[model samples]
Target: MTILLMLVQIIVLFVLVMLHVAYATYFERKIIGHMQVRLGPMQVGWHGLLQPIADGIKSFFKEDIIPEQADRPTFMAAPIICLVAMMTSLAVLPFAKGWVLADINIGLLFIFAMSSLASYGVVLAGWASNSKFSFLGGLRSMAQVISYEIAMGLSLVGVMLMSGSLNLTQIVEAQGNSILGMYLLPQCIGFFVFFISMLAETNRVPFDLPEAETELVSGYCTEYSGMRYAIFFMAEYIGMMVMAAIGTVCFLGGWNGPFAVPFFPPLWFLLKIYLFMFIFIWIRATLPRYRYDQLMDLGWKLLIPLALVNIVVTACLKAMIG
Candidate 1:
């Protein structure tokens, strides 16, 4: 019975996240449209309010096409792998005071591990497609993820050290007595590194070299079509949400706000996540894509060193105060 309950919870969470994944794209389109001073998606349902639902139906009906030379088994598995890994990390993130799927002690480590695992889907999608463009996109994504992952981990080390706990909820609790309500002020450097790295992590604009439409013709997913292709995109948007959620936990003070909502307490949490999501969309609308070499330089030359320095400074301050 207990195992069945867990399975049911997992299914519920998965469906909820997938729904969010669908709506995120619709919102992105609507937001970007308004940003460019154009009406976005007015045709579907009530100014395209139900556009994502329409899209899901269309995707479900679309024919699944497999390339002649593509590795059938691997190609099919890649998107599933991506989606599973992306969702697994959400288990440990606390939504409200007691609302979380998995409140594991080593939640932070689990997230990093799941993140590393998620990259395999990208790499396999490229290699299995048997296309040079896909292969290149896979390689670029792998390299970019590896480089930024190092810096992102290092930046979070400061938070981990200060809180003395790997659990995200504990980290938030630690911030209650902090200089500010959040780690954003003291860990500004880490926050900056995290923000930039997260954009790269999600393959968003300015760092989206892996999926450049003009260059790689949709990058690693050029060969995919129908629901298989849609799954890849779903993974991408879900990834963006995961990163935003993690950012809220690490820096923005998870579920901690000036005023609490009268109804569900997680409103503060959702609001912060929404703010990050909006900033993500705002960036996509406002910024131009960065050149590949420039992207590499920004990650390795700039963000990595900054993260390291933040760690050192944080450790020294902690020692002195102790």
Candidate 2:
């Protein structure tokens, strides 16, 4: 019975996440459109509310085009690998009090591992495509992820040290149920580094060198089309949401708000994720992509060092308090 219940929960979570992934695209288009003083997607069902549904249907029906010289097996598997890894990370996220798919002790580490694994899909897609542009994009993604992943992991060391647990739920509980109890106050430097690293990790604007169309013709997944392409798209949005959720859980105090919604426990948690999502979209609309050299320099020379310093400081604080 317990196993059956878990299976049901997993299916529901998958459905909800996929729906969120679909609508995230619509939301980004609308937000960016209004940012640029335009009405976005007005033609698709009531101010573009149904646009995501249309997109999913269109992607499903489109021809699955494979490059003539592409490695068939790896090319086919790459997007699935990316999508599956991102989706798996969703299982460990604490949506609200007592509301998590997997409340394991090493949930945080598991997410990091899954994120690292997602980069392999990008690299494999690039290599398997047998296209120069795709190869370059894949190489770029590999290097970018390697650099930023370090910074991102280090940035959260402070959170783990302070909370004294690797479990996501425990981290939230350690913060207490108050707006003032959030780690955002003491870990400002770590948060700054983490935010920048998060942008680079997800390949968002100002750091989106991996798929710079102007340079690499759509980067790693350039040869992909139709449903496979949609899967990659879905994976990226899911990655964004997952990173945002981690930030909310670690720094912003997950589900902690001034008032509670009786009917919805995760409302505050969802709101924090939205807040992070809004900033992500806002950055995309505002900033231009960084040069490859600049991106590398920012990650290694700046963000990583900042993250290390944050760790040292956090350690000192922890020792003194103890």
- Best by TM-score, which number? 2
What root-mean-square deviation over C-alphas does model 1 reach?
Answer: 1.1
Q: lDDT at 299 for candidate 2? A: 92
Residue-level lDDT of model 2, residues 145-215, one tens digit each, is 99999999999999998899999999999988434879998889999999999999999998888899899
lDDT of 1 by residue, 241-270 (tens): 889999999998999889777779888888
Q: Which residue pairs in candidate 2 collide?
A: none
TM-score of 1: 0.97
Clashes of 1: 0
Per-model TM-score, in order, reads: 0.97, 0.98
Per-model CA lDDT versus the true structure: 0.90, 0.94
